[model samples]
Target chain A: MLKKERQALIIKQINLHNKVLSSDLSLTLNVSEDTVRRDLHELAQENKIIKVHGGALSKSYNVTSQQSDTYAYEEKNIIALKTISLIKEGMTILTSGGTTMRAIARALPSNLKATFITMSPLIALELIEHPNLEVILLGGKLSNDSKISVGGEVVNRINEIKADLCILGINGLDFDGITDSDWEIVQVKKAIINASRVVIASTISEKLNSALRLKVCNLKEVDYLITELPSDSPTLLAFKEKVNHIL
Target chain B: MLKKERQALIIKQINLHNKVLSSDLSLTLNVSEDTVRRDLHELAQENKIIKVHGGALSKSYNVTSQQSDTYAYEEKNIIALKTISLIKEGMTILTSGGTTMRAIARALPSNLKATFITMSPLIALELIEHPNLEVILLGGKLSNDSKISVGGEVVNRINEIKADLCILGINGLDFDGITDSDWEIVQVKKAIINASRVVIASTISEKLNSALRLKVCNLKEVDYLITELPSDSPTLLAFKEKVNHIL
Candidate 1:
């Protein structure tokens, strides 16, 4: 593989697992240990990752304030700004957690007044910064990997609320459905979709056509799809027919 | 007042109100605005506060990661270590949010197995670092100042669960009761006290014998009082008769 392609894959691995072992990367990439070490060191020096004794940790995973160092932060921030245009005054919005959602919360206009219901504590913390916004945190057993509330309690709470909009920061978006690896989080995401009148899927362009272990919902269920790229970009052309609107 | 005394009071004021303007501090302290500005600048230089254009913010109130710059961090950490001795294996621990509780969560042993229920999203994020701990975040409307879920929903959730131990990072503890400034948070703390089998109040020595506007519970309700001071310290003598133990 090309060096750029190999480094991108390593970053993807770190983003997925929050932490990656150099030994495991060496085995998976079929590269020597020295090559893996060099890649990790280069990434660390670039402020992309925090190199540890045995491996490296994603910057966003450890520090919530260090969004500048997050993988694809610029693209995610673009998605955040685009997502803001959909929000209206006095609307009740439900949200699932991820770096994309965090960016959205940070980018919200200070004058906008809305009610936000989220399963992620980090997002809830960020949303409360807006004086005009009301933030409701869905309480339940928190998933360590996802850093959001999950389990049956969260779904039960979602069932009782009728929100005007739902924003999902999904892992994968394929022709069939929105898929994620964790079953509990997927369950919460599914409930969120059912509870809202309109559902918007916000992701980066790279997540297009990707599928994970578990399916969350079908592409038809999403009313809007927002990505970093322009609506007329060739990368999003195929998904135009799948959703009601592409932004 | 002595410069040391004035600076100490300034830190106390910052802790009470997350953000304080130099003009307000000058009026409250009966000092010139220039003196207040100089004090804020010195505190900012020591990394004790984050000075802004017209005022300053408590280090712990904004960036959760910058705990080292938190006021009396060493004292709070010492209390955290002592509080750990009270926990046993497989206990269900309920926590309130504050720098003191955050210290305790960070100090928890990795091998210890326990379940933690908390209203603060920040504490939940900190507690999840322990692999063996189960973290349940009570969902409700989040308080912007406290950064914890508050309201009827949170109190109802606390009513359902019977926690083995409740750890309260109280603002004030006096002969009358455990007190705080916010009415909504005091209600939630009162509920937590009634829902737990034993209540533990963790606070710094400075807060001892201080009383705020709202009362959470009576002194007799607390099972233990843990502070940075030794149990036999003269500062704790007044509180010795009110609680079962003081550490």
Candidate 2:
């Protein structure tokens, strides 16, 4: 099996049982114990799972096989709640793909009337319960790891869309600006950023001040910043100087 | 709690524990047993769960709380397996959304290289693990129950997309035509039929000949038909004259 598939299977197993034994995963996946351990270690590094001796436990209380989220999924969930409060009825939103974004999708009020133009298929599914919410999936080439449509088609499609607000999930954000590890995703983010009136970048405080391969935009380009941290915290204070708003 | 929210919670609880009692759900949700029983009854009507006296069991084995798809989920799964065999690597496919399509999405080979243009947000999530597959979600108004896109945007998008093949999930298919209960979905499927080089329809044999609200297209419009029934069985032989291909 491919490494991605194996990791996904491991995460699914953890979500189903809330914990997994390395030996069991090795047997079920038909892979080496060392491979299972390595996968566990990598997931731990991503903060997606808690590494335990001989096994791993889910990072959150109840993972629904959605690969949960990053570094304190519950904390990000709180931030997601705040993000939804910013949404006014009948507004158009441009949402980028990630676990944090999916949380926002989950927390959206079912009765709220809104239009969401999103690049993430996963976020679209998360938002499916809303009867009044209109979802426009920005179509294009798909990126393997990120699971978002990327590249030229997405960029071109975004050019034709103008949403009231844009909520982006970032890998890294620093003084240098918002950066992503993949160029294709960075291009698509640029389009999403360009198409919206208000662009808010959301992530856990743990990811702040980090830089990656390609820059999506400068901090000045981001209208607002959101994290689990208090808005007035020193962590956000640095970002407040670079951006117009923080939440 | 809203009826939808109540239903979602019941589904989640059922997924967490293989079975859940109505009394326990009434206690947990702070609703009356009557309300809980009503919710359970509604879900059971949607074919979402197996309703037993006093409680409910999961509709299928190991439902991941992604609303595990359709009546006779296992029977649809058999047809889904055969659908995958028709797909060639690197083909661009136009797919209509439903439980059967989701089963096909789940059964897809991880190594297969293909692009799927679909209207279902749920199906997109189901297809996310295929590293080589490109998923383009047709966006528009979200239908409350079906969870697929509809209206002008999806119709217009389909017009521009000429896929190599189109696979449609139907409410009913008989000599009259492939039918659906939703007018908006029928409009979108009409556009899909116009844009595809080859059009195929799949359903469980139990749903055959049960026509609903709208007529999507004539049986002559379908290039292939797939059912759980044996191709040479007396049951499937009825559809042989109308559809060119069967599996």
Candidate 3:
């Protein structure tokens, strides 16, 4: 077998079983144990796997895949399903990156057709998985901490596209306004809100009424508020008075 | 433990073994078999693993990690090493996306400081792993097949930067000049060539003398031609005559 194919298979094996004996990999791949050890060593160097005395262990998966089991996974899933009700066919959508937004992307119907624009390469990759979605990735200096595109270049690109709706995954939301920790992301979010006709801010209930250092937009600018909580719940009563819709 | 943490641990365990018995997981995690089974089911639904009658297996590893084992793996490693020799600390580098460039990124010295720019998100992510490197991702319409940003936006961004070197992984090269099949990528490469002071074309020796449908640049435009073959080898004789440096 080709080395690439063999190593790929070995990775699959390790991921599936959580551990793999070098002897077994050699037996399965029909390569010498020396070759298997060498493959493990290379994979280890890549940070893809951990090499032990007799076998290898998979590196813990990254956050993208780990999103499914993230904190408040159930709540996020609820918001994801609820947010889907607001999206319609043939809409141009702008999105911010977060686990909550990813949940909404995952819950999207396979047949839904839309154009998705985002500064997050990871989110762009996820959005493209939907067959009917056209994904445009806005590029600029990639923030090492946020993994999202930033700078005046990205903001300029956002101004060129008049999106039908904007789905913002915000860090903080309160009667004062939407807020976030990073200044660059806040700038990008400000552009997204202005480029779209309507804005929907999605956050977990725990984040409601919370504020951060950098302000994004006023609570009045957000046309819709989405959370896992029931629309009629007392927790949302104050927000419901400010936003057009709460779900 | 949080379900996210538990599931992440479960994923790590499954990745290590390539297959894990449900009963074994229950004992190791100190959870009921039912909980283990539920965890396995949720992971399966996410397409993270394959559920079998008795256990689960991992999806094969992706192309980035598999680059080490890719076609002409050894040859690419040689090219990668040679390419590193051309790099000096504190230079601004522009790179095209491919296994060869990734190999070079992997081989970079830990202490080297450089600003790397690219239209590939995958490359940007890989480049950021190097502590001293600043990664700029040029964004535009992401081509589904190539996974590289294309369109006027990316080209405009390239025009704004004066890079010290452009390391391109090309599809074809001949006495006729550099050729590729994709027009969008060709456009991006043309901009890369115009923006950089020096251009290094790296490819496996086997790709030499080949031609694709679209043209990228003339043979003389490339300052350096890098192949796995030794510079004095008979195969490089023709290319050595046109390019200033053959490595």
Which pairs, if any, clash in model 1?
none
- For every prediction, compared with the true complex, DockQ reads 0.34, 0.26, 0.20
DockQ of 1: 0.34
Which residue segments of model 3 deviate by more than 4 Å?
A1-74, A130-132, B1-75, B106-110, B230-234
Q: Which ranking of candidates, highest lDDT first?
A: 1, 3, 2
Q: Candidate 2: which pairs clash?
A: none
Model 2 lDDT per residue over A1-247, tens place: 8999999988998889777888898899999999999889777756577777778876654334432354366778878987887899989999988888887898888889988888777787677667678777665555656777777877888899888999999888999899877778888889889999998888888879877667899999988888988899987887778899898
Return the TM-score for chain B, candidate 2. Answer: 0.73
Chain B TM-score, candidates in order: 0.76, 0.73, 0.75
- Per-model TM against the reference: 0.77, 0.72, 0.73
Question: Over the stretch B98-183, how does candidate 1's per-residue lDDT look in tens digits?
Answer: 88999899999999999999999999999998999999999999987678999998998899989999999988888898888788
Q: Write the per-residue lDDT of candidate 3 for residues B26-72, one digit (tens) a residue.
A: 89889998898898888877778777777677755332444444778
lDDT at position B170, candidate 3: 79
**Which stretches of model 1 miss by more than 4 angstroms?**
A1-69, B1-69
Ranking by DockQ: 1, 2, 3
iRMSD per model?
Answer: 11.2, 10.8, 8.2
The root-mean-square deviation over C-alpha atoms between each candidate and the true structure, in angstroms, is 11.8, 9.9, 12.8
